[model samples]
Target: MSELLNTSEVFASDPSGLLRGLHRQPVLAVLRVSERQQAQHQLNLLVEAGLRHVELAVALTPAWVELAIELRQSFPSLRLGAASVRCLKGLAAAQSAGLDYVVSPILEPDLLAKAQQAGITLIPGVYTPSEVARAQALGAPAVKLFPASSLGPSYWNSLAGPLSPLPYCIAAGGLSALDARLWLESGVDAVALGGSLFETSQGPQQPLQLRPGLTALLAWLEQRANGDLLSG
Candidate 1:
């Protein structure tokens, strides 16, 4: 475990080039399925659709770490990570599998310190201004704004100013395509989606697939990316 925390140059300050690099395609996919094969298949689909960043959040199981490694081997350019990482075991799993980073539900000093030591980027979840300040003080390069849809996209706009230069913000949990548009417009650095893509009136918890809204969201994201390039 010491090797995990003591073997990189980006360990000192912040994610050397992690979150800052997501401006090109600002959508992150959070895969929270129970079946391993299903997760692999869904991830393959996301990659085919041009998604490069994803978090494996299926109960913080080491299942994610294993999947992240496999995905990386297949697509070297892909950015794979584990999610819901809230303890030492989770962090160890993240490093054991050599994932690019890990995401947590809340900021924990020890977890952050471990990430900093390992140079494995950690994007801790934040809700209020005080949490944001603490993350910034900890030198977090980015933070995930969890359950952002609960507060609506406007919440970001409300907090963005006072938290000027906020750690690269990612809006996650229950966000739809329109919500993604609004959050991005509100200056959220990125938006993450998971089971929301497959939600239906049915009560079954199905494994992720290229569901209806997903394709549309991908197309829209691609178009926005092109527009960003042209505008730039």
Candidate 2:
């Protein structure tokens, strides 16, 4: 753990390079399924479609952690992480489960410190410049722009300026293909697809598969983003 954290710290101050270097894909999909069967199916679908980066929500239950572990073993090349990590326990669970990183809805100082000490990558959710600054102060490698749909692409575009030493921004929450394209074009390092990708009318409680709509959208967004979405 200490060894991993030591390596993680090297990129703590400049996560943009790390994120871009590690995740060659343009988007990171968020999975919030509750059933193990459904979860595995959805993961397999995404992998088959060429999407590798994913954040499995930890709020579900111990099964979520187990699924993460299982997925990691099955898909060795998958970049798996935990999302909605609100407290120490969630962070600890993610670390124990051996996932790649943790995502929080809000930035917690103690959580950040502990993650740094444990060698886990904590991507805190941030919405404003102040929040972004706060995340940077905590040494976060990346800051997820939560409920990003609420702020719209214009809001994301507005942040491109003034936010010096900008952290790697992840456009998450209610992201559409057009929205994803706009965010990526607006300079966001990466976009996160949540319920919009894997969830269906059955809701999160039921097992779901990757939607054809989302698959098409991802392809379109990847092309539209063009040079904005890096491959190397």
Candidate 3:
């Protein structure tokens, strides 16, 4: 059995084990709302619907740093992270805010190195096989495949091997409930869901609805857990 990393624990020497810990859940909800109240509400909804991992996209709100602090305090059990981190300053702010992880839309070597020095888990964004290799070289146990829909699942399938220390891929952008299964089947480690996973009928400010889309994701997790049932 793999030991769980405490929420407060900094980067361990073996970060791959940390990545594997996150992969156990395989779904990371990306919170991208502007209002602090709305973000809190959406986070509650996602948590209630069985999401244990989430990334708060910083660009979505001017008060993202404060909100990250508040959310971290509000939900002690949830693995909260800050996304859209563009530079060393952003990474430092996230770490200071007590976020459990950090993510970026672009791969920045300085930011990654600094995050490591700060003992924060940073998952940098990468799109191409070369970029993926670069991220792995930097010691990231996982990398976010931004605009994943642009490259599509087939492209991921092609990068199967040779990206050693091969970072686990988190598929983000242009992914819908239906498309998630394809990406997972194509060997992607996990999917980062944004606005599309919620119901739009209630307007953008309301808490997201977790049915249908979340249900599909849950089913996939169940199947993944029960390998015999899926394989047979």
After superposing candidate 1 on the true structure, give the runs of residues whose Cα lies further than 4 Å from its correct spot: 1-16, 58-64, 199-208
| lDDT per residue as tens, model 2, 1-232 | 0011245555664332336443445688888757677777878888887776878888646776776788778877678888899999898778877875788888788988888788677888998889988887777877888988888766755765677547667878888644566677666777888876754658666655665555665676556556545642
Q: What is the alpha-carbon lDDT of model 2 when measured against the actual structure?
A: 0.73
Model 1, span 1-232: residue lDDT tens: 0011222433454453555456667788887756657666777778777777877763555665666667667766668777889987888887877775888889898999988888778889999889989998997777889878887877876775677755678889888754577678776878888776544434446544565555666678788879968998
TM-score list, all predictions: 0.82, 0.81, 0.82
Cα deviation at 141, candidate 1, in Å, is: 0.4
Decoy 3 TM-score against native: 0.82
Pairwise TM-score winner, candidates 1 and 2? 1
Which candidate would rank higher by lDDT, 1 or 2? 1
CA-lDDT, candidates in order: 0.73, 0.73, 0.73
What lDDT is reached at residue 159 by model 2?
65
